[model samples]
Target: MTSLDDLPLRDDLRGLTPYGAPQAPLPVALNVNENTHPVPDDVAAQILDDVAAALREVNRYPDREFTRLREGFAAYLGHGLRPEQIWAGNGSNEVLQHVLQAFAGPGRTAFGFAPTYSMYPLLSQGTGARWIAGTRDDDFRITAEDAAAQVAVADPDVVFLCAPNNPTGTPLGLDVIEAVYEVARGVVIVDEAYQEFAPKAAPSALTLLEGRPRLAVSRTMSKAFAFAGARVGYLAADPVFIDALRLVRLPYHLSALTQAAATAALRNSATMLRMVDEIVVQRDRITAGLAELGYLPHESWSNFVLFGGVDDPRATWQALYDRGVLIRDVGIPGHLRVSAGTEAETTAFLDAMASVGSAA
Candidate 1:
């Protein structure tokens, strides 16, 4: 039998693992920060109609520029954004990959605060760019001054800031984005995959794009719109910054059906996003419940909660899994992260935690 060792693989990727979370057919699954709510029936009907229409042109290549989809995203983002400022891919990971390919390659470097979205370093290395992991303040917070100093020292060709960071659920401030951009020489990416779940009045890095061509804010429909299965993610940036991505993307990268469905979803953005308000309710419920159970739950602007003080994360994870409830361990010592599911699913998770006892 052949194995990886017997094949000729790139030495840089020799020991690296592909990014993924655990998969299971659990009764209550809250891992991976997915929006567990199903797409609204009315919106789903519209998407079906659009996708069916698109199928008639399946034999032809999709719009290489994806113009209409770009326009849809620009309208949805709505901070005076225009189609010229938008770029998208099958998912936000691919969107970020384009940035890496355009700006950072072998000999150049990419930087992100430590314990960020696990995919940051992986995407950087996959592009042959060296990945520099910088330190974070206590509880995984990054201060503007500290972030700027670290970026200056690393001198990377790209920087990834996971707004409302994953695994820890720590929110990034606008000050940090401004500070990093002032000191960093490279393109700065703010991955706001969960931004729709943030407070309504919270400012986004998109607001910083007007004067900073080097800054980009990426978003995805997977979380708030319940369109993860549709594989649509986009970004808002300066027109010139968007042009850089054009140089690296393949011709007709997005499929006609994908563009159709995403555009339809965007048209119904108001209805689809109503789920976010409900999810936030469950998120706060989880936070309050975790604290009552004697666990320390981090304040989350996103749709998940990362709770600490678990004595044996693996054991507790197994216990919850045994009860048909699955959450993420996220490799943080004494910590676990769980997404905000529908009300009933959230109840099941909290009940499972209570029954399992606080291992701490």
Candidate 2:
């Protein structure tokens, strides 16, 4: 077996670990912020039929442009978007990488607020762009002033804003997003992977796309659409920006099966997404349960909750795991994050937490 050290590898990636959370396959799995609900039977049936149809054309290459998928995505977004203004990839990570490859390179830089999505910096570094980890306030919130100030100081070639951020599960204000765009000399990517789970009144940066050519808002079907296994993530941006991504993405990047499944899922969007409100209900239940257990839960607009005040987060995590409940120890001191699972799974997690006595 050739060891990694024996093989020729990029010097920058020599000692870096790959990105992933633990997948222990416990009874109550709530670690990765996945939609716990299975694809509803009706939607699953449609997806199977669509995929079977595509299988008949497996010998042919997928639509190089994924034309119908783009059209379906545009209709789903419904903010006057056109197919030309939409782009997609296997996942949002790939979409972000495409954006970075087109805009940021060896001499350029990308900046993101710390404790946001862990993958932002990794993606930037992979593109050979300098990565700047900016700071947020004590509550893990970024204000418009702080964002603009950071952009003005760093002068980065790209900025990433993870709305309803992961690990912390806090939503960024539209003001902060627009403020960063005003000051950023390069592209601004707003990641809205969990937007569907956010409160009904929460504003999306999608509304700010009118005159901002540098702005891009990315979304995923993994969470709300219950299509994580389908690997379809997309972005809505100016036609110019979308065209630039075409230059960097691989030819026929999305597979025919993926395109068929994702398109079918979007066609039945209402049926596939019916669990969103229920998930939100479970998220609130988890938040309230955490508070009752004497933990300080962050205000979350996403499906997961990040809470603090654990004497030993690792030990508490282990305790929960011992009871067959697997949550995420996101490396935040005294903090842990758990995704909203099905009602039974949620109850199991809460029971495990109660058993562990995770009070401050």
Candidate 3:
């Protein structure tokens, strides 16, 4: 067999590991920050019908523009967005790739604060863009002034702001976004995959999109809509920005089935969102439970919680896994992340943590 070392590969990817979270089977799995709740029955049935209809037409190519899907997404967003301002791909990762391909490539650079979505750097690397890991405060918060300073220093071609950021679950304030935007010389991408799980008052960068052609806010149906299997993710941006993504996306990138399923899910957006409150409740429960167990839980506006104070994060993760519960270590030193699941699942996770003894 030819060893990988014997084959010619891109120099940048010769020794790189793929981006993925552990997918170990466990009785209570809270890793990956997936929406634990399955799609509701009624919505599932509707999606089934839509997808079946789409399958019949699979002999032909899917709508290249995904016009109806874009319209559905715009309607679901309801911020007076037009379909022309929307762009989507198989997932938010692909959507981000489109943006990076369009704006940050070759000699350009992409900058983001550390402890953010792990994929940002990887996406930049794939595009041959220099990835700059900027700094965040000790509490994982990025203040407006600090953000502005970093942007000024990096002067990157693309800036990524992960609101309700992964690993840390810290939501960025509008001030921080505005400050970064003011100093950024090129595109600013805001990843809002978990925005629906945030508090109602949490500011969306979409509100900041009126005149900022440089701004793009990406959203996903995977989290709050419980449609991860559909692989639908989108962004709201200026039409000019959206147009640039068209140049990078593959032809018929989204299959007919995917567009149909995601469109149906968006049409039933109200039903999909009904689960947010319950997930938020479970998230708070996990936070409080971790704190009571002597762990330091970070404030989270997303559907997951990141807590620290573990003497050995890997050991704690293993201990919980031993008891049939699974959560993410997130490579954050002493911290780990656990997504909010059903109430019963949350209880199981908490019980498992208690059995393992916290902060040890």
Candidate 4:
């Protein structure tokens, strides 16, 4: 029999498990960290109208510059970070790759905290940069001083900090990020993929861009904007780095339809903000409810909570799945991360936890 082994897959990726999101047949689902709200029917229709208007020009190539979407995203985020300084791509994941390609390569080091967004390590390996993960203390907390110390000690070429961190949902506050910025000898990336759900006490790292030329803040339409399938995300960095991203990304990466849909959603920023307020409420409510149930989940500034200190993490994950709930089973000893859904969904998960408190 002929083998497909000759096909060009990266040598390093040979041992990796394919990433498949577990979608179950259930009314109340909470797996991926997605905003519970779908785009309002009216809003979606309006976006289609806008996209259709632009579709007429599909005969020509898309705007390689992506000017409209870049400006629209900055206005929607309304960050002090300038639109001119923002760069868009297929997803924040792609934008991250651009950063890696620009700064990390063979003989370079990319350091990130353990239990971060899973993509960081994969990208590091794929880009031929060595990946270094620092272990966090018991509370899943790291001061900027602590991170800064790691940078000085490890001497990584680039660093990734996931604020309101993935899986753990621990928010990195401004003071901590500030200290890291002050001490970082290399480029520091603050990945705020879940920032819309972060508590006010957790300020975005974008505020530090002026003083830190080696800083980049990544954002995504996938989470708060409910555009995961749209594949639109961006990063705000110093103009020099943003230009580097422009030079690195394939020309006209974002299709015309995507630009129009993204722009339409951004114009109605109030809708996204309203959804964000609702999601934050749900996240807090779920965290508190989990605590009351004898499970110690992190008090998150993101859209999910991490349940830890379990005995057999594998068995616990299986029980939840058997009961028709799907959650991300991640990281080392005694922990599993689940996202926040509706109030009912959160309750169902808690009830399931009570059902299988014994992770045997």
Cα misplacement distance, residue 127 of candidate 2 (Å):
1.7
RMSD of each: 0.8, 1.0, 0.9, 2.2
Q: TM-scores of the models, in the given order?
A: 0.99, 0.98, 0.98, 0.93
Q: lDDT of candidate 3?
A: 0.92
| Candidate 4 per-residue C-alpha lDDT over 263-346 given as tens digits, one digit per residue, 9 for 90 to 100 | 898988777667777777777777776677666777787888887767777888888888877787785578778888776777
Residue pairs in clash, model 1 = none
**1-360 per-residue lDDT for model 2 (tens digits):** 888999898887788788888999788899999998999888889889999999999999999999999999999988888899899999888999999999997889999999889898889889899899899999999999988998899999999999988879898999999899999999999999999998888888889998999999999999999878778899999999988999999999999999999999999988877899999999999999999999999999999999999889999999999999999999999899999989998899999999988595
CA lDDT for candidate 1: 0.92
Per-residue lDDT for 344 in model 2? 97
For model 4, state the Cα shift of residue 350 in Å.
Answer: 2.8
Ranking by TM-score: 1, 3, 2, 4
lDDT of 3 by residue, 1-360 (tens): 888799888887777778878888788989988898999999999999999999998999999999999999898888899999999999999999999999999989999999899999999999899899999899999999989998999999999999989889998999999999998899999999999988897778899999999999999989999878778899999999998999989999999999999999888999989999999999999999999999999999999999999889888999988999889988888888999999999999999988888575
Number of clashes found in candidate 2: 0
State the C-alpha lDDT per candidate.
0.92, 0.92, 0.92, 0.80
Weakest 10 consecutive residues of candidate 4 by summed lDDT: 1-10
Off by over 4 Å in 2: none
Tell how far residue 118 is off in model 1, in angstroms: 0.6
